[model samples]
Target chain A: DAMVIQNPRYQVTQFGKPVTLSCSQTLNHNVMYWYQQKSSQAPKLLFHYYDKDFNNEADTPDNFQSRRPNTSFCFLDIRSPGLGDAAMYLCATSSQTFGDTQYFGPGTRLTVL
Target chain B: GESVGLHLPTLSVQEGDNSIINCAYSNSASDYFIWYKQESGKGPQFIIDIRSNMDKRQGQRVTVLLNKTVKHLSLQIAATQPGDSAVYFCAETDSNYQLIWGAGTKLIIKP
Candidate 1:
């Protein structure tokens, strides 16, 4: 099945420590997105890449950054993980521009200690 | 009792019955709408979608209704089952092409 894949389904990091989550897609979608989701809340878009063009949400914190080294792989790097950053990180891909149906991964659950 | 804000609004339904989930979107200019289902410890999965131009769209056992006048959207599920228990969310595509998401509703299935 052509699907999105995320590494380290559960991650634990110390406060102020750096952590990286990875996502790769087999769907060959041009757009890849990263979202932060806290318990019982909606998935909030942190940033996305459209074939190397990075688009960051205005409200996204500076600590969070993303890099799409290639078409199939994208990484989310948190410069300093905070306690509040403990949440599920989801990766999704859309075939084209916005309004396209997104394919999502199982998500990486981060725990900041 | 836990504070109301601590949890998502929940709807409990009996298995084999029909289920309806509702959402009120904020953008009047939103031209596209999608419904997603998120199971526990998993990312959201696309269920169905309806465009502003159309009022209704249906999929396998699922239907989405969009009311542009009221800015309301709904998802209807038939023959609810244990597998249908999950958090359902509605999202709209704004003018910027960004998806503005709604607070999700949790569905519970009773035997």
Candidate 2:
């Protein structure tokens, strides 16, 4: 099945350390997005790549960054992990034609110690 | 910033009953709306979507209703099952195409 995949479903990192989460898709969608979901809260958009253009949300922290080297792969890098950064990181993809219907991966759970 | 929000934080329904989850949006310019279901320790899954031009759209056992006048959207599930228990969210997008998500509603099934 053509779907989104995330690596290291569970990640543990020390405080102030950098961590990277990866996402790959087989659906060949033109848009890839990264969202941070805290406990009992809605998923907040961190950044997204529409083709090669990167769009970051205004409220996203400086510690969060994303890169899409190609259509099939995207990575989220946290410059310095904090205890409050523990949350589920989700990767989603959608075609430009049907941008409303986004397909999401299983998500990576990050735990900052 | 304008965003989408749900009226209720949680709901408990008996198995086989119909469930209705409501959401309100502050962005009147939103042209697209979607409903998503997120299971524990998983990502949000697309359930259904309705464009602003349409008032209703249905898929499988789920139906989405949009009321442009009040900027309200709803998801209706028929014959609710234990498997349907999860966090449900409504999202809206304008011409910018950035989705604004709502605080999800926890749907609890009572067997």
Candidate 3:
């Protein structure tokens, strides 16, 4: 099936350490997104990539960064993971149109120690 | 910062009953609305969506209603099952392609 896939379903990192999560899509969507979700809260958009153009949310912290090396792959890099950064990181992909629905990966659960 | 929010935090329904989850959006320019379902330890799955031009859209066992006048969006699930227990969220995207998301509503199915 054409779907979004994330690596390391669960990750544990030490405080102030760097961590990277990866996402790949067989769906071949043009736009890919990264979202951070804390317990019982909304999945907040961190950043997204439209081809090679990266769009970061205004409120996203400087520690968070993303890279889309190609059409099928994207990566989220946290320069310094904090305890507050412990959350589920979701990767989603969608068509280029405004109203297109997004398909999601299973998500990576990050635990900062 | 703009936001999409839910009217309720939790909803409980019995099996075979129907469930309705409501959301409110801030941006009037948002033309696309989607409903998502998230089970424990998983990503948000797309349920249904409605365009601003339409008041309602239906899917397999779900219906999405959008009331532009009030900026209210709703997801209705028929024949609720234990498998349907999860968090439901609503998201809206403006013409700019930025999708504003709502705090989700947790749905509990009672057997």
Candidate 4:
């Protein structure tokens, strides 16, 4: 099946340490997005890439960065893991023409200790 | 400001019965709406979608109804089963690009 795949379903990191989560899609969509979801909240958009053009949200912190090396892959880099940053990080893909239906990956659960 | 909210935080439904989840969006200009089902430990799965020009749309076993006047949207799931237990979210976007998501409603299926 052509779907989104996330690496390291669960990750544990020390406070202030840096961690990275990755997402790849086989669907060959033109856009990719990264979201942060807390326990009982909606998914918050962090950043997105339209082909090679990156769009970062206004509220996104400097500690967070994203890299889309190619059409199939996107990476989320957390410069310093904070306790508040512990949450499920999700990656989604959508076509430029029909970007409403976003297909998401299983997600990576980050735990900061 | 764009905001999307759900009427109820949780919904309980009996097995074999139908379930209705409701949402209210503040952005009237939003053109497209989508419904997603998220199981525990997994990302959201796309369920159905409806455009602003349409009043309703249906999928395999799901229906999405949009009321533009009230800026409300609803999702109806038929033949609710155990596997239907999950968090349901409603999202909308004007350009069908960047989506503004609503606080999800947790659906619980009871036997």
Largest TM-score belongs to which candidate? 1
Q: List the global CA lDDT of all models.
A: 0.92, 0.90, 0.89, 0.90
Pairs clashing in candidate 4?
none
| Candidates sorted by DockQ, best first | 1, 4, 3, 2
Off by over 4 Å in 2: B1-8
Per-residue lDDT of model 1, residues A33-98, tens digit only: 999988888998999998889999999999999999999999999999888888899999999888
Clash totals for all candidate models: 0, 0, 0, 0
Model 1 clashing residue pairs (backbone): none
lDDT of 2 by residue, A1-113 (tens): 64999998999999999999999999989999999988778888898888999988899999999999999999999999888888899999999833458899999999888
TM-score for the second chain in candidate 3?
Answer: 0.90
lDDT of 1 by residue, B11-84 (tens): 99999999999999888999999999999999999999888899999999999988889989999999999999
Candidate 2: residue B10 Cα off by (Å): 0.8
Candidate with better DockQ, 3 vs 4: 4
TM-score between model 2 and native:
0.93
Regions of candidate 4 where Cα sits further than 4 Å from its true position: B1-8
lDDT of 3 at B8: 47
Name the top DockQ candidate: 1
Ten residues in a row with the worst lDDT in model 2 chain A?
A: A93-102
